[model samples]
Target: MAYSLDDLLNPQVSKVTRSTDNLIITTYGARGQGKTPVATKMEKPFYFAFGKSGLSGINNVDFQPVNSWSDFKSLVKLFSNKKNYEQLHEKYHTLVLDEMEILYKYCEQYVASTEGVRKIKEGNGGYGLWGDLKDEWENEIMKIIGSGFCVMFILHACADDTGKIMPVGDLKRMLPIILNHSDIIGYVRGNGSDPETGKPIHSSLMLSDTDEYFARTRNEYFVPYIEDYTAENLVNAYYDALDRQEKAEGTSTVTKEEGDKMYEKQRITFDELMGKVAECIEKMCNAKRDEEVVDIVEKTLGKGGKVSQCTAKQYEAVEVILNDLEEALA
Candidate 1:
């Protein structure tokens, strides 16, 4: 079967009528800012702690301590499998990955071990290597995403020399791709002991992006800031955002000029290009037939052009194919 321009223009992806319990969330904060405790509050969470010490005081959490990158890869393989994921989902509805920075190190270690390179730089054929790392990381993460389980990724926040708080080092290189997958990105602020009482003050989660750090929720309905942060509140805000979306769907319409203006307002950076390529690869990976993969390639880059060779100029075409495939799948 072939799709025509009419089909492409009006996709068959069903209207999203209800809220989903599962979400992809990322939260970062300074050490001892209660990032882990906040995650532990998520529904039936199963933790995969990359660091050694964080979980000592945290209780009632079922976790697998990851000793090496290989262990983490094994877990990914296990959970990404459909039957295995089904069984795991019965017991755990959420998966929490702690220490995002450490996980990046593990990814680098895995890449180094497999590629026999100590340094990752464009000079050292790092573009392909970095792409490989990104592909592997994104591929595994998407599988987990498609698994229909809530995911909470925890990262440590660091202040740059000029005092901008954000993810640093290798993890910084991958933040854009990770953020593309997240529905919510929050920065936790754990209030330290009060001067007079030596007890904790009110801490909060920042959901709006700031000049100082990376943070944002998907919609206006999501609480811009969460005070006395708990996983429940975050989840509720997610539902509210969904409810608003559901209510607003088809209630109003966008004129072509307005749609064009809205589209023009979107900033598609190079990192987003990388993200689209990742999505293309993900589609190829899950493609039911070799012909479907070939169709994607032909539709995006013309015959015999590899997706790995896609440039920024090819972004819109790539997105069109991806959207078509998504609608077809849906």
Candidate 2:
């Protein structure tokens, strides 16, 4: 079924559009659920876990297991900020959020505590909190999606009285947002061993959406370099996925030199890039200026290369060395 543009534009009329290429994989089960296994398979990824431990077991990844909701909020804000993450994002690929149930709790508490909402809640003596928090929750979600980063939201599957599966945070009306916004939604369930009798076990990954569009393999976009549960794998997968997108658009990955130039455009300085320049200078001097035997080679000189004479990168190296000198003296 289709409708005219004007008809579709009305707020009352509903439409679904996937504007972001992000994938939100929700992993759930009991406390020991292997939700982490799925994220570990990705390349160049980082984990911000609110629960679960053994982060050291995973390699090629950065892990931030938060002990409190405040830590989670602050980290999320930092990661999404363009100033902090831009350089890091250039070097990495995936961002995974383990135990999204924690963030779910934070969102509820956050919205309920906001000055505007708190006033309403206080006036109502706590009766209006649920209504007040809906917009705040949506705003938090918008920030996450618009962050332009690959995110994985992990949750636990809870069994209701009816023995039906529900996401851990489903009680707070989070399931719908988790469902509608997620590029992929799934669960992990395992067999419970009967204490009395020995029996075979069965486990499966449950898909949330019945739509045919989601049935296609997500691997088509991002192919793993190898079989491993490492952040490097997530990173590799992210690159491959993005490369596939570029290939479809008739483009290719840029060389390191080109990528450096692109990064320099944003005022980012690479230590390795500076090291490469020093190596190149040494190579050229060895071939031509070896006879001169200069006592020291300086990339930048305040005496000759004044404040305005150097490029931003040259200034960076000079500033770093100067900072070292100041620290040494102190």
Candidate 3:
């Protein structure tokens, strides 16, 4: 076929937004951070449990225990079938790969076996073996993602000899591919049970990269960290952030300087808000009696009685109080 000048001259405008439901996400953190439990709460998740202990007590969510790379290939083949994929698409909204580090090991094992070698580096006379392994890994994974299933990868944090934590191992080599494909990479940490409900609470999800761990979110609306982490809460935050961005962009046509100013104005941070709350609490404690303190706390936080239990609106109201107190104290 000959190249067409007509086609060369015309280019379609690409979509500026993507569907939130189909995001490619990777969540990683220390063990017992509720990574698996929180992932199950994601939109109609279907899990591929690759680690031996990954599915011990999980309930209600559909899952398959993947043992070998060949088993994974069979799954790819099954999903390649049009009818089978349709059935899956109907039943599941997200396809989760639990314990991604183990999956990387499985890839290495498969590569080693296929080349009749004890180690992956022994394959192809030590030439292109790593590339081959990476190719196989990315190809198989992308096939499933291309089939329209939202993909979530879960990884456990590994600490280096120097005590730096990361999602490492054979996965370190595949980080580029994972990073390229994923829209969000969050590091989860902290563990506490809700005092009132007795349910497990994942304290926070860190979406910003730090010296200790790797994490990121491409969405500008997503905060650097999410407290009291859950998939539902995360999703709601994502959409709310998206809404704010969209509304900001829609407000007016302006120069870059004006737009940047507007963005900075809208960027009131969690740390800043919490700092204000702390200041207010300290002032009230110093200036009032015990009974007055109780009354003020009840008036501010209402029945929640704790900052963690407060909703977004309650936090906003608290922010208002903090501002008023600052002025009054000054």
Candidate 4:
């Protein structure tokens, strides 16, 4: 996992690799399909509120209210420190309110040359506090990511012409955290047919598991799967490389002693190293769980059992295989 200067020069990761500092997830949809609901479901374990009011109709969620941006920043710091948010999620995760488009807008404003960065201030459409929003957003995202828990960024998308790409939308002027960060790009679509005909009309999850899939569908590696004439079989494809690394290397062991060993070898910040160790403790610590899956796979294959394809999307077979591979990695 050696990182060369050249690799850093360009702001991209290797073919199928993922780093801890950049675990980003974004979900989009037209209407219904519970895109937010599913996202909220995932964050139900740890939902922090910024305003003083109740979540009102928000279900399957745990709410912690914050007062200001500074408080939010402080929360991010504590989580990264691994001191706070330790109990929120056994693994440490945070939910930022409407973070996606904000970061996108932040990026756009940053590129426009903000007021604070330019100083002097031009309130009349001139650079202002928002001008420096991008730099601040980018720095904060890294902070949250560094802090243990996984982050969930909610976003809104619309069609924008005059650019490259379709189902296109401006990152709301929020662009900083997005320009160089965000590991996963997800879109939410709903089944569009007849209710009597068993058509789904809620938000569906269309995920980008690999660059190849992205290129094939949108002719652009990052374009979301929201265009017309698409299928209801939108599958959530994510990079499995992270889990695979642990499985591929038999060297992975789980005792505290082994944790320390892996920590030193990983050489990321100590906290990040420890976080992985914690997750490992939950999985590898139990020998039965680790061995059970491989045992099942072997027995199934021995019986001539073939993997089935039930992925809603077209090429779902590919999705099924990748899922199997991810299981192996796990």
Top model by TM-score, which number? 1
Q: Which portions of model 1 show Cα errors greater than 4 Å? A: 1-6, 17-21, 121-128, 160-162, 169-172, 194-197, 246-330
User: TM-scores across all candidates?
Assistant: 0.68, 0.50, 0.67, 0.48
- 133 Cα displacement, candidate 4 (Å): 2.3
Go through the candidates in order and give the clash count of each: 0, 11, 0, 28
Candidate 4 C-alpha RMSD relative to the actual structure: 20.6
Tens digits of per-residue lDDT for model 4, 45-149: 355564443344666566566555565666667666645544645643446454344334434444445433433244336545443554566677677655545
Compute the lDDT of residue 184 as modeled in candidate 4: 55
Candidate 4: which stretches are off by over 4 Å? 1-22, 50-56, 91-96, 99-131, 162-173, 197-202, 208-330
On lDDT, the leading prediction is 3
lDDT of 1 by residue, 98-216 (tens): 88778877877777667777755532465547767777667766776655677888887888777878755455455766677888889888877899989876568999988887788
Stretches > 4 Å off in candidate 3: 1-9, 16-18, 80-84, 126-128, 160-164, 191-200, 251-330
Task: Work out candidate 3's RMSD over C-alphas.
Answer: 25.9
| True lDDT of residue 78, candidate 3 | 75
| Residue pair clashes in candidate 3 | none
lDDT of 3: 0.73
Model 2 bad stretches (over 4 Å): 1-21, 52-60, 83-85, 111-123, 160-162, 191-203, 208-330
Better of 2 and 4 by TM-score: 2
